[model samples]
Target: MTASRSSTRSPSVKVAEVSPSAASCLNVLILPLAIFNWYGGTWIRNELEVVVVVVVVVVVVVVVVVVVVVIIIVVMMIITIIIKNHNYAFIINRVPLYSA
Candidate 1:
């Protein structure tokens, strides 16, 4: 079996490989989108928007999951009681006749 060799280049050498003009062009390509020109705003506004959206989505998901779990538990309890008792009439008669 033959092993393949990987050459690791130093960070300085890698940065030098990309010409200044090329680097500046790359910056131009990236900067406009990264600068948050969606509505022409500052970095803080963009970060805040991202944080708010994430928090809202997380809260909504948590509420939905909790509601679903509670509903499932209630349904299971009702089913278990019905199966254990085996007599619907017994429960109805008991509830009205007994105070405790």
Candidate 2:
């Protein structure tokens, strides 16, 4: 198998590829979104918006998954307990005694 160029790129080479002004922000993928608008302002705005949207989506998905898992576990446990105790009764039958 051939080695990938980008994955094999050195740290210094990757650093040199990006401009000094674009070094920060940690939003390298945002550059393509603002390709039409080369000005830094539009890029920064679009980048922030995309990051926020992605983060919110991820958080919502995680919460939904956790809730679903908890519900499933609780349901399973309840079913197991009911089946195990199905033969048992909560009330005992007793005959009334006559008064003297």
Candidate 3:
């Protein structure tokens, strides 16, 4: 027995309608003047000043936390060394050791 094959066709393009009463498409002559005069330079300066303040606050907080952690670690190490060094000789020798 033999089988049959089928073929498909592509779709066509579409067209849009334009009106005569519409204004010209390139009518943006006053856009730059409007934008520059709208907010001026103070807006950008204020934004940058706020960003710098926020960054400085973040850095200060991180440095303080790091210093606190380092101090805690140093205190713990000093305590450990003192305990090890000042222990009685007999007490240390009395501890048992495991061997294989």
> Which residue runs does candidate 3 get wrong by more than 4 Å?
1-45, 88-100
Q: TM-score for every candidate vs. truth?
A: 0.41, 0.44, 0.44
For model 3, where is the 10-residue window of minimal lDDT?
Answer: 21-30
> Considering lDDT, where higher is better, how would the candidates rank from best to worst?
1, 2, 3
Which ten contiguous residues of candidate 1 have the minimum total lDDT?
A: 1-10
What is the number of residue pairs that collide in model 2? Answer: 0
Model 1 pairs in collision? none
Q: What is the C-alpha lDDT of each candidate?
A: 0.69, 0.66, 0.60
True lDDT of residue 39, candidate 3? 61
- lDDT tens digits, residue span 1-100, model 1: 1233246554566443878997687566545456665657655456456556556766998999999999999999999998877967777776776565
What's the lDDT for residue 60 in model 1? 95
